[model samples]
Target: MDQIKARTIEIFLPTGDSKEVSQAIITNESIKIIYISKSEIENQKKRISKIQGCYILVGKDDDGSDLAYIGQTEDFFQRLNLHKKEKEFWDGVYVIQNSSDSFDQAHLNFLEKLMIQEAKKVKNYKLENVKDGNNFSISESKENECYLYFSTIKTLLKTLGFDLFVPNVEEFEINEENKFYFKEKNNNFSGEAIFENDKLIVLKNSIVSNEENVKDNYIQYLKFRNKLINEGVIQKNNENLIFIKDYPFNSPSVAAGVISLKSKNGWEVWKNIEGESLDKKYRQK
Candidate 1:
């Protein structure tokens, strides 16, 4: 296995406030990241207006789900100014550029397309752009450079507390010890989940109870379940609901609740192949 070397990242807060507009850069790297709020656009125009780069607009939908728009432009300030007046959903934007101003339109286009493709794969945000960017041809060397540039963008974005590009379930080695199961014979609900990074991921194609079987009015599981249905994360198949893709929940109980459609002690309900409860396998040790 190749060893991953540590790199230094420096974040500079222009307004002396962490929440305000900030710039980030990795040591000896040409790539730069600037996070600017919509409200701060006018103030930042003089600094970033002429930079040719790719940007991501981030905000929330009417349902409060995470929403985003990705694009590339030669004039950062002008493009964002247009977005400010035309698009009402984005609250903030992340501008990615090179310090040397070497990125051409073709580079930006390739980066925009790659970012959109990866964001769609992550499915973490609702994309505001209806269509993907044009797949323009680029040399193999430039394509590799764009991919490396995107890797830094993804890292810096997450460091800035924006995970629009982060995969919900990162690819890693899997084993029996990391897997858990939930089955309800009466309701025909059977789910397969894995506990990874302290998160419980309900795998795709897992069957869930279509009906809300809980009597507690305070439980918000039903609302979340409905949101998933509306988002097409889960859909009805015959008499039961099935996950359209792997979804991660903060805790095992929440994952169980969404699957069973009732309040459940996930630690007690989720079991391994040996019928060992999550509580016994993890908590007890």
Candidate 2:
């Protein structure tokens, strides 16, 4: 096929609705056409099947018939979404479920083996990082992602051992309570929050360098503090910035974040267990 050949695709959403869109197909008269939906490559469920899980998609590609793509999933829909988002090149794939199918743990293991077999038979992207969180890797990085299009994936598989456990775009859960000192990175970091005793703490800070001394508080932080104040977390002064109950407070960075959102001070934004900034807390100490 010509590299410049025009391509077309009909995208089906999770809702089962679809839209036809333009795409590309690297084709040459020498290479036969192979079509398989990534979703079809995983498990599906029926209304009556007591067992629930995904199945390995079994079908044929250009190489030959019965060349299956085996994969396991609790929610086929979730896995299907992953395939669609990561790869948008499956063509001529008729969207239909296999009739009368039920998936169980044994089925899952068998499906995995089948997928592994298929991986060995054909040049395909290895589902790397699946263990960490369903990460399927076809290439190395962003650079490799660009180079290893669907065609390149097959070629790479032919050259390298089949392994698809690539780290995917996902967030890991780090559960631990620690006091964090925030600095300006404009990076909205998210993690679990734990409330200990009377004070609230974040799980571990994932990014940035710190042992969790004190955090540069935001308005949200202040609001949380304010709630505590109403509930007696700290006592407030009649000043513009609230004060702790005579304990010294820690200030935010020199350039406070969310200045535009609301006028705040590095000094008053932060507080201690005693609810005082370093300025006043030191005196009390």
Candidate 3:
């Protein structure tokens, strides 16, 4: 996997923690990210309005899935003002700007398309903008620069606690020994999985119950299942809900709970091929 080397990031919390308004600047880069609340957009208007780059209006929908609208303009502040009056879904905006004022409309358009495509692939956010983001003709060198800039932007977003582009769990080079499984004899569910790097990934093609059958009223499990369905992480191939792609859950318990549709002790629920449970494995450690 390609990677970005770690570097120093200077942060400015203009309003401290009261308003959740902060800006991050990376050393030796032209990119500056301003994380601002919707209420304070006007307060920082003069500062951000002068920059030219792409901005993301980010928030969550009723179902609790992260949603965002990505757009770019030479006059960042004016475009943000327009969104403030017209859009209601976003609670915050992450403004990515070039300090040197080098990104023109064409460059920003290309960057916007790249960002949207990445957001769609990550499937971490429900994008409010239409998929028809315009693409512009650019030289190979310019394309390279824009993508490099995009990568840096992702790092900054993660630094600010927004990981929209987390690497898909399936993409990891997980070792075979680390694999585990959760099997239910029920007609609808059974699957293999692995927990890696704080993410529990139910492997691709794993079968999930189309119906919730857990003993407890684990509403969150049900909601998570629905969220996966909405995100295309879970799909119906015929009558059964199958995981079309490897899906990452926040924890092993959540992963096991969703598959079992109940309150599960993941330590006992997930086991290796030899039937050795995670509880025993962790105890041995």
Candidate 4:
């Protein structure tokens, strides 16, 4: 839960300026994680086809929800080639491997299971694999080793900007005194928010106004409303719309707009326990 320690990450850009087609390597670690876009994979087929390990297909669904599928194989790039033909969703992949080339089938199997479980728990991404992937067993020592490798892989993945795992609030900052609250005068809409870094997270079980009364002109907002319901972030029960889990919004206004079912200045709407508006807090800063 402590701050992420400073670590060295080496990225090899094959095409010089193409981030979508690069290999990210962390030295003195067990696994190699490569990121490549579908468009660039064909050119690097020979290079990737030679290596084998666990990989995750990363993409976004039509509802704008993140999606991922985790798998392990003896021939990594070959399987990806098949996915290119059969699966059409993923735009990129994070191919994980043992730098020492010591990871056997058991090691990759264990990593795949753990990865699937963690992805499901986060609920931030929609996993493509519906049923549980292979649930094979491994040796006790190998299990521990794979777990340590998995931790390393997570750190590397986060460093690359794909934060599939969400850490607890305490791990980032410790500002509990200035908890922000928002409420609407016309409806029974209310919510609590806390800051982590520059991003604000509206707490779970927060209440929002039902969209039935929202004007038909706000088509985008209505679509967003349906997306939230589909994602299980918002629940419509007893004629009320409520946040079932903590949701992060880019800014105070964005968060306020979602709950109010209309455009609102979040800085003016969110206030502290002492009734100090977010605008006032910003001026203080």
> Which lDDT value does model 3 have at 251?
76
TM-scores, one per candidate = 0.91, 0.21, 0.90, 0.91
After TM-score superposition, the amount by which residue 264's alpha carbon in candidate 2 deviates from its true location, in angstroms, is 80
lDDT comparison, 3 vs 4, better candidate: 3
TM accuracy, model 4:
0.91
Q: Summarize candidate 3's per-residue lDDT along 68-156 as a digit string, tens digits.
A: 99988878778888887898888998899998888877678789999989888877778888874895688888889998898889988
Assess the local accuracy of residue 35 in candidate 4 as a C-alpha lDDT between 0 and 100. Answer: 84
Q: Kindly report which residue stretches of model 3 are placed more than 4 angstroms away from their true locations once superposed.
A: 1-6, 212-220
Per-residue C-alpha lDDT of model 1 across residues 1-285, encoded as one tens digit per residue:
333667889999998876669889988889999999999999998878888899999998899888899999999999999998999998899999999888987788889988888888888888887878986889898989998998899888988888888776668555676778999767768998888778888888898777765667525878888888877788998787899888889889988887877878999999999999989988899
RMSD of 1: 2.3
Off by over 4 Å in 1: 1-4, 212-219
> Which runs in model 4 stand beyond 4 Å of their true positions?
1-6, 168-176, 237-239
lDDT of 4: 0.79
TM-score of 2: 0.21
lDDT of 2: 0.32
Candidate 3 positional error at 181, Å: 0.3
> Total backbone clashes of model 4?
0
Candidate 4 lDDT, tens digit per residue, 1-285? 444665677888778754667677776666778888887788877768878799989998876688888898888778988999988889998888787899888887888888889877777778889766776878999999988888888877887778776643535443557689888567778888886666678877788877566676555566676688888888976878888777788788778877777777788888888888888876577
